[model samples]
Target: MPVARPETSDARVIAHVDMDCFYVQVEQRKQPELRGLPTAVVQYNEWQGGALIAVSYEARSCGVKRSMRGEEATAACPEIQLVQVPVARGKADLNTYRSAGSEVVSILARSGRCERASIDEVYLDLTDAAESMLADAPPESLESIDEEALKSHILGMSREDGDDFKKSVRDWICRKGADRRDKLLGCGIIIVAELRKQVLKETEFSCSAGIAHNKMLAKLASGMNKPAQQTVVPYSAVQELLSSLPIKKMKQLGGKLGTSLQTDFGIDTVGDLLQFSETKLQEHYGVNTGTWLWNIARGISGEEVQGRLLPKSHGSGKTFPGPRALRSLSNVQHWLNQLCEELYERLSSDLEQNKRIASTLTLHASAFGSKDSDSHKKFPSKSCPLRYGVTKIQEDAFNLFQAALREYMGPFGTKPQGNKKETWRITGLSVSASKIVDIPSGTSSIMRYFQSQSTIPSCSTSGCLQEDVAVTPSASESCSEQKSVETQAAMPEEDISITDTLPDLDNSYGNMDMVPEKDVSCQSNDAKEFLTQSGSNRGTQTKTNGQRINNSKEKNKGMPSIVDIFKNYNATPQSQQETREDSTVSLTSKRANLSSSTSHSSEVNQEGEDRRETEWGYKVGEIDQAVFDELPYEIQREFRSFLRHNKRPNAGKSKGDGSASSSIAHYFPPLKK
Candidate 1:
């Protein structure tokens, strides 16, 4: 649930902009012949005629809808072009639309503070711009209003013929003596109109916008009109517009919360909600939500548009329903690898372009037992310290799935074979990289100080395979790499200086839990809160690295597995120091002076023996010095440990094993006792 903030002021100007059939527009832009034709963007055409994710206005006119399947759309509009969403690694890739949205954001951000609400939606705080325009060039004094501005659909205006409606809108905006607040809204509408035009001119895309005093009203008005139009919610029309508005149509209340109000309180509209007192609503919905309900009842919302242009996290996932379920561990691993590859590509782009790094790699899956009727368990989500490589991600993800699988299948693995059922069937799988933070620029000196530790040895440089592979095609495979190239192709040719200033990608808005003003179910609400609510679905421990150890007995029972490859890959020297101290205190002080070098006389440390210790078998001497220096101390230790050749009884033990590397060898710590 979203926490309610202080009461919102009615004087601010906020605008919400939504692209018209964004995916369709992008596809049309790519293939101009498809423009003005009935079209829809679908994914995975092999499955039930494919799922329609976006529908063009022309298709809508022919009775086609986004909810329809590809075949259903064709039946509705025979001429409809069912464009497939780009596919890579056997899953739908939305990066093209995402990049296009980013282009739009770069333009919209010019007018004021902009918040990217989703892939194709944004909320802009144009209050300052509106106020400036109102003071500098009032709409009433302008010699001629832009024709595009005249096309705005003012809320509460009577239904009139096309020409008359346009004239009324024009006259109202250019009225000589309108209220200051109304004048401000008029300026906002003009600005939004200009922004929309600019978007079309530069990107060949059409969009709709709503201008009002706050985010809620603006969002409501934005959708009132269709493709390539704008709407304004004047302060005077707030009550009239909201009074007749269904409670389910308001943001945040469109789900079960709205249903509850109608079924329990007999509240059917915004006006009905006004009948309840703040105290009464608080008593029913808790203080925060109750106050929030009271404010929205009056068409007020304090939610501010955050100024951000990047997504908080990167993820790639696909759902496999019913018969399409994955039944084997190899099959699950294959899909997981694909998802990780896609995620790693985005993470790399973010790091390279935005100077950010994700700290956590999480895996989520939905599964069911094959034979056991009672085994309808959910696959737990698992997360581990994020390393910057595709192979690392795949290895970690496989381990996480294994840990989750054990829990979902119980201690016995699966139902008895006599029962004549499969082990498990995975219905959905997704991997995401989160807890992203900016890489501190101009900290080279500080980083060098840490790397100067005398015990550490110099190393050669190595590159990640993920960086070398173009997993998620930037634009489309057919398009030039320049348009969608998220790599160095889009960046300056010169090397960036450590102290050089870059755009701030760190500033972010807290997770907001706003409801859509539509009759959507609670599940819809949950999906909207993907960034916040997603973590809760994963039943794995959320502790950071080195904190806990997974107790699964199956972890190291066989030959070195994928999990063993990157075991303790994220361990830091600090953790190793802590472990050494703990051992010293527990026993005699003899363990305290143990050399960091692996020159002992044990068989695992035999003279002239050459072996890799780190999970990826990356040796400290062979690793790239520049990349190694930039890595966190924990990762540095991981590589150093891998370079060491120790043939002890626990030589193959994973991280979190105290006897292995004198540091937590387990990449994923188990749940706390």
Candidate 2:
């Protein structure tokens, strides 16, 4: 449904550019011999000679149409040539066509704010450019205009008038004292004509364009003249042109909505809608849609062209219809691997060219059960934090599919009986990456800063944080200094040392909780044992013969203390004293508690269980405030943003005191006894 905007929106100049049989043109360009032939681009030649996705003009003239099988096309036009789309990883690859479209977009974007509507179409808001041209180089004032501009098909003007048609177009364009809107349209016409010429010269491709006051009319006019032609929708011709237009031909009205209009209101043409009042239409349809119908019926639309040149997301998928459906896990994994590999290549390219990263990986599958009753059940889609690398994406995507399969199968379908046929069949599979965002500038330096200060070992082979680095402050520290000491100790050293690349930051930050629930079920026995042992030894001292034993004098062995790391940096005496007092209190309290803890071993065990249950995964609040204050402004802002996103929910509900210790405690909740 469309929405109406203020009357002022009608003043802008808009244009729609559409490539002429884009896929066929791409194929023709690849093989010059196919330029004048009746050609069609097809895929999967094994099935009915593949299916025609694109048909060239010569083929269309010979009665060959899109969606017709290649065999049908050849039967219609005996000499028709079929070009199969390139195949990679056992699926059709369209990257060549996509690259050609990019070349066209690069030229079209120069004249205005361009929006790539699809791989083969774009909408440009040329209001600013048109206004400037009209003010400085009005078409009428020039002695002569480009010949391409003279070929424009002016709406409401008949070409049957013969020899004077081009002259008439020239006159209308250069007509003095024309309406302001009409003059703007004339400037737009010249601009688009030049852009089209540039595209042809540079890319060896031709496109059709339409110029008008708004996107709808421009889109409508662009298609009026085909194959390297341009059309103009004048303000004076809008009503007359739309009156005879079929309602079904309007944008967004070609589907069910158009059918409804004819079946419900007996409206077959745009002119038929002129009889109903807006309120009457609103009574049947909702207000927004009704008002949109009323306005469009009168040749009005306010949709603005967005200023985005790149797609918001990228996806790779394949379908296995009927007999081709996958019935076994290995079969599904094989196809999923191919799809994931394609998706990874696209993601890596986008990161390299655009300096952006996608945060989510989504897997969509369609399946049906062997039983007739289960055929109607839909397979639910699943998503998780996306990790970089082909291997990582493939593993995560497969895990996600397995998760969805379990839900789709339910308890009874978990394990099939021995030698029994599988009960479900997968018909479609797709993997997409989305939630893309640009990497912040200066992030490289910030990463380097953290890496320089790191003292612990790098990430383990499992990509988990090493538990041997003991940085937490003991309980003897005084309250005043506890916050600063704890803050410094809480920062995870693994976060800085996980990966040397910026894109991999998501791997650590996105799933800061150490392990995702889906992955936990699939961990090896060694990993599980490591987790269990680590959880028990977190805050306990060794004991022998019912007496506490000191292992070594080197308490902070793995990583140097935050205070020591920053000793060379500028610091106030007051802050240093506070840090020292906090460390002393924490250490003293731990020693006193160690001697009396045998009787409280059960309590200690219970406490450890509670810690395991409530752990928030990443220790993100461990940097000392004094240390943070010494960072560059950009780095400070980045750190603050990270904390805001990763902090646990309801974490600020702890008792509030205006001290740094309470603030640190707010993020890392204390365990209950």
Candidate 3:
């Protein structure tokens, strides 16, 4: 049911552009000799000379129609030429026709906001353009008009008067002080005529158009004139145009709804629907549909044209009717592979050209069972996360089909055995990719960062660097290395006084207050014990050289403490202090201290045995909730996994020992005894 909008008025200027016998025209362009001939495009000519999908107007005059067999078309029109659709991977390929449609859309999009209604049809909202033209360039002020603009069929004007009709249409178009709605429609007519000429000139394609105040009337008028002409539905002429029109001829009323109106209510024409009151119609068809029917009978529709240029999804399917149904798993697999290959190619093209990716893959199938009761059961459709590459798609599709087959077969039926006769036959198969989204900018930089991290060697606690066999530096690393060299070459050399820089470092270290030696040793011992306890529980930790040295404190007792090393490097000898007047010796001593401090810091920061920092360097409980939430999704996942792994033992202990408090104990106050 359609709902009427509040702004249902004749203030808008809309046009519907439809190609003239689109498929036939595409074929005629390919074979120049087929131009101006009675032609029909067919598919699968091997089966009863194929079926006609599109028929040319020249052939339609001879009674050749769509869905007619190729042989029947020839019998109806002896000289009719039939062209078969291109076949690839055992299926009909329509890429040629799709590409041609894109060419036409590019030209039509220049005049207004265009919506691609179908491959060969488009709807344009020309309200703004029409208003602008009427304001700046009125039709009456023009010195001359295109001959094509005068040929448009005006709805209210009768053609029985011939010259008078043309004069009336011309006068209405150029009439001064006319209704604003009429002026807008007149502007739309000229714009559509120009767009049609541009399309034909640029793409060698002929199209017809209809100009009206709304989408419904625009679509209704576009088809009124056939081939390469256009029609305009003026506001004053809408009533007369729709009064005699059959109810079945309306857009949404062509199916069961129209049949019900005719048989149930004995309604034959749009005028007949006017007799019923709104309340009475609502009683029969519900509120929305009743209001919609009442509004449309009076030439009032509020359906707006959507602004879109490309299709939301792409699908390739083939049906096996009657005896041609697939009976075995191998046959189904063979067809599925072909369909998957086609889908993969289209997805790859979209990703490359439009920078878009599809997130979902869906499979639809229709089948009938050998049993009379089971024949009516439907094969449920299934969808999964779409993965790129042809082989992965095929594998996933086959698995989805098997999953559906199980549910469709139910309890009484089992998997079809190869040695036994099959109980089910597949009648149709199709695979579609949807949920397309554009790839974000800077994705390449993110990918490069991850690749660089993967190539670096990882270190273990056993004092060894282990390189992954499969990992290696990629092109991004090579590019970065080249950039480093270029930057180094571009920099200007500067002279530095070593004496001046050495004193700054010495004074900075001398003034810093250091941790007590006893406190440092105690912290180291506590960390070692914690690591040992954690390693014993995990059963995977290895002892480092530093840990071994700490454990043998009684044997290698002469080893200097971590605080002693830093103090010795920062301390200034009394002899040097006494000889401060000797500038050369003072400078030498300062350089020695600076070098020692640098080496100590480097050793503390090294990987494996000398490294004192833990992997995360912070306790899980110390992490702030607000700060943790700001991390990227991938990093958050890793943090969650680490938490789960470390908390498992604690969770088990709390559950087994009744003395442990609950995990949520801190959330509430203790209950009164």
lDDT of each: 0.62, 0.64, 0.61
Q: Which lDDT tens digits does candidate 1 get at residues 558-652?
A: 21111111222123334433433343121101111222132232332221122111121221122223334334433444334432322123322
User: How close to the true structure is residue 77 of candidate 1, measured as C-alpha lDDT?
Assistant: 88
Q: What TM-score should be assigned to candidate 3?
A: 0.66
Better of 1 and 2 by lDDT: 2
- Number of the top candidate by lDDT? 2
The alpha-carbon deviation from the true structure for residue 395 of candidate 2, after best TM-score superposition, in angstroms, is: 2.0
Model 3 lDDT tens row, 1-673: 6676545555999999999989899999999899999999998748778999889999999999999999999999999999998899988888888889989988888888899999999999999899999999978888866678778898987774766766777787889978999999999888898999999998888989999998889999999998898999999999988889999998888999888889988899887889888787778898988888888888888877787777778777778887989876657777988998888877766655555556567889999887664557799787655544464456456545654664576544443232345677899999988877554322221211111111111111101100100111111111112222122222222211000000111122332222222221222212211110011111012111122211111111122111222233325433322333233322223333443454233332232121212421222233323223322223333445444433433322122222222222112222111
Which parts of model 3 are misplaced by more than 4 Å? Answer: 1-10, 160-165, 371-375, 415-419, 441-673
**Which runs of model 1 end up more than 4 angstroms from their true locations?**
159-164, 375-377, 414-422, 441-621, 624-673
Worst 10 residues of 1 by lDDT: 500-509
